[model samples]
Target chain A: MATQDKREDILRAAEKAPLLSPSAQRLLQITSAREHELMEIVAVVKCDAHLTVRVLKIVNSAAFGLLYPISSIDRAVSYLGERMVVGIALNDCAAHLFDKQLDGYESERGSLWRHDLQAAIASREVAQRARVEINPDLAFTAGLLHDLGKALISDYLRGTCAGLLAEIEQNQVADYLEGERHLIGIDHTEAGSALARNWKLAEVLQMAIAHHHNPGAAPPEHRPLVYAVHLGDIIAMMGGCGTGADTLRYPLDQGYGAFFDLGGEDLAAIMLDVQEEFAKIDTSLAETKEN
Target chain B: MSNIIIGIGDLGASKGQDDILKTFALGSCVAVILLDPKQRAAGMVHIALPEAKINPAKAQERPGYFADTGIPALLREMKKLGCQPNARGLMVKLAGGAKVMDPNDTFNIGKRNILAAKKALWAFGLGPVAEDVGGNFSRTVAISLATGDVILSSPGRPNWKL
Candidate 1:
């Protein structure tokens, strides 16, 4: 259980795990949206034929919260908007990459989907409050993808989730990072950072993903976005709107206080808004159950 | 061993007895605690919003979730229980006011709830002894009347005793 050994173990496991570079690369290329880059993403998805199918599946999936189903990829792109389409493409690529079910993480098939949606919504709302020049799209994308490493970890670890959960319960690990560090040899932050690097994601996003659990660990320049992801992760987990092993952990890093200028009442309002949104999602969950 | 459990959106407990005043999943909702050690009685309020002025009627229905109404109401209840405000050794502590919104994209509800609670306490000449407010995490907050210790639990976080 030594920290160094644990780190080594995690590095070994991560080394053997299938890299998400392909999906990450696809996302980076798709998100570019510049003249040549946009054409590249569009052409890649359009030409691949497989991605087109995956995009259609995601658009029509109940996970998208869409009222009506669409037929074609171009139509789906048009209906969802280019930005959303790009976001959806990234989501689909991630989903495809991690096709196998993740062990140790609790939640139904679409729990990850729900978590992504909630984080995106929460991120957009928080950015507005801070009056930061956040690309709602970027925030949403980051929020949705923040936990990508979780899926990778779960898939890679095989059956380690149950043991990890036991440790979390026994030690009262409020955050999964502790458990991940103890059991898996590497935490999601490092793995996520590696994946981000492999995918050629911007340095800021990679840093944000790595330091999301504790944005204060990152430098001041990257603090804003990482802080957003941290908040998004906390809100999503607390809402209980999503299912995952993380739902059990209630982490409160003291460093979180330094990130923002929030007082007690504003904190209350934020919780209220989060709860309000959760209520909406809860209704949806109920409807899904009723159906 | 018989502990009184405070349900969601509600707070009720007393000191010297095994009272557990709690608020579940407090997002932007404020859980305010007033403890009178001498009286050995404690009271809590789970305010849903920052101020009562937003909707007087709704405040009347859920007085526990508004700053203007809930704070006063909890104080009155504490006084009725013989825990006179400022008369007995009254110590106020506050928790819960989580930001469900993103730090970048959402309105600052956590900050708003804390501010409103502070203002209400200031108006009533009360101040908090300790506090843990404002974050993206949803908090399940409880107060132990036996020791007037406030306990908070959140996912992937440490518990705090304020």
Candidate 2:
């Protein structure tokens, strides 16, 4: 009934959320390490026969159009790299959250998956241009999972996306996040932060899920990764891949300038690149889910 | 009865009276609708950016992605349907150029897209007859080739003629 009561109910729902598959948990743990080797990811996949086949199938599955099909898991892991491997692991585990419709956002089924996929690709591209050394793979992983909380909140916000849009239109609230908080006790970022902790996700990832919409508020150490995901989410919206109602309603922190060396022109370039990459993976990953 | 759906960086045209030119979820992207008033042939281009220099290779592959090129590309599509567009006979409508509540966003692409679409139209001795652009919400557009009615709709909002 009350906003706080709703927030508590949402948090309790998150606490009961399904855990990521063991392989996915391992991938996140190793990828977040400072000096991890690629073999660490390969080892994790090797342990899960189902995940191993998904990885190999994606690499050879016309997605890459490899002339010679290599049957080795090690070669497949190296071929697609850590980011795609991480994506396969997580999607295998958390796809119900990723693929669910965001009725609250007025989005249809698969909208969240497409947005997160584009954000993941865009975040990886943005990280590649970071002024300081940072883990681009981790950025990709965080982007893919940043919007997980929206699915959790969608049921509660259903049938009210219009009123929220009007609130944004009249400038009664600064943006959708404000509208979300004003109506509900918490926004997607706060709800997602709870899920990240509930699942015992890596610390940097929790910061990313929490502060992606407002990276400047993130702690100084995790700011670079958070900023990468922040810009990535905006790029996905700009490229016309956002979830339905609340497409580009969040603020883009100008403070990201301190973390990355991207110019206005770079945003356009990243968007085009994201479009190209998204096309390549859209059907390929859909097949992964069906399998 | 039928729809010629245009995606970002994509364009389509139809001479059939049963056709509707449509584009969806236009966040910051701008959709340029061209209808030959006499022939009733219609076309649409979904433009994502103002200029091509940002990615020349992409412009070459999908000219509809940039406003400067998208306007001309849509015009070329109209010509393919054997309908020539003149300043007086052409019905032009522009929709979508929404911001995300951040006025200071250096990349206020919606505004930039509107300006560029206008500049590109003027270069071809054309201008919009009707437009609904610049807001903080995404738009979906449908142009009826049967009736010449341009319907602009936003999520949870009533559809209105542009």
Candidate 3:
């Protein structure tokens, strides 16, 4: 197939990728609202039985270390807090998509899911430390979905893994994304953006997924969120969470530190926090798997 | 046999012959493996940064996060496991410390990590007997307590002894 045709096919497949569940959509809407009313979020979460059950399971999980078993959605929401409840709900919804093996990228089963969670946590931390103007929830969501394209394009790459690896070695391709572009005519960033558009995700999220590898390419309006996700991805990789074949292939954008006015000390602090946060998440994930 | 995973900013040591100490996806970070062929003990530390002075608090909290602190910490733990300091029984191998990105060496964290690992080893009057370092690839390294062998694996590449 011609490169352009292959690109179009991948885009079509991405567009046809599974849409967000109704519960996830509602949770996203509730969390993304400008004004957060706990009651409003609670009402939205209660409408979805699966989301409610999953949220309860998470709160009651051994990792959460809750002192009491919570039987009701209200109690679970109140105990876990609104942001965590929303994150849990969305993660459950998205797990089916990201939890599979991505062998083309040399990722084991659940690697992408773990990476997304780590990046999401890191994004929130970066936003807080950098004092970026974007909402923390938006930054987290964008970070979680920034690599959605990898899931979309995994099948296509599986067939060409051997050849692509050779080309990458022979040409010294900068990273997997560059190799992806050379072999498939479109990179994960573009495919992820397309997936976001198909899911009708917020424009900021689409932009972040599209430009996370190159935040400078993002429009001015979306730069803050894009930059947050970009930094979060790097932080996740550095912390050794869910790294695959593309790990360490992307260069650190030095401009990001200058743009955010983040000194080395600031980054170190954020990294420390990210390590702690990821440790907690990993424990919870392990508990979930055990159950 | 179980594998003890050394995460980023962390280190692990095993005294049991059935245990394998391993670290994965070493990008710019370096994995320092120390083994005692006589005692059949192995230790691995995943060092992310070279110096600790920049973040003294972090260094104090996570000694395995920086080379200066991590190397000494690993040595201490290995000593507890009956690994000696002498050159006859103890063997060292280094893997990772790749400039995976930034061909221009703009950040150069990998190069710095390699240098720091060597410097710290020199403080102990030691050096790597075998090294597989400095490249554009990520590596997974493991040391077998039973065999005292260090193995390096990467994507699209065959696994080999270091």
lDDT of 3 at B20: 86
Chain A TM-scores for all candidates read 0.67, 0.97, 0.90
Error of 3 at B83 (Å): 2.9
What are the runs in model 1 whose C-alpha is more than 4 Å off? A1-24, A30-83, A96-109, A154-176, A242-245, A248-291, B1-162
Off by over 4 Å in 2: A288-291, B85-88
Q: DockQ (C-alpha) of model 1?
A: 0.06
Q: Give the interface RMSD of each candidate.
A: 7.3, 1.6, 3.0
Worst window of 10 by summed lDDT in candidate 3 chain A: A257-266
lDDT per model vs. reference: 0.62, 0.86, 0.78
Please report the candidate that would top lDDT against the real structure. Answer: 2
Whose DockQ is greatest here?
2
Per-residue alpha-carbon lDDT of model 2 for B74-148, expressed as tens digits?
888788787765544788889998875564757787888999999999998888988999876788899888888
Clashes of each: 58, 0, 0
Q: TM-score-based ranking, best first?
A: 2, 3, 1
Query: Residue A141: error of model 1 in Å?
Result: 1.9
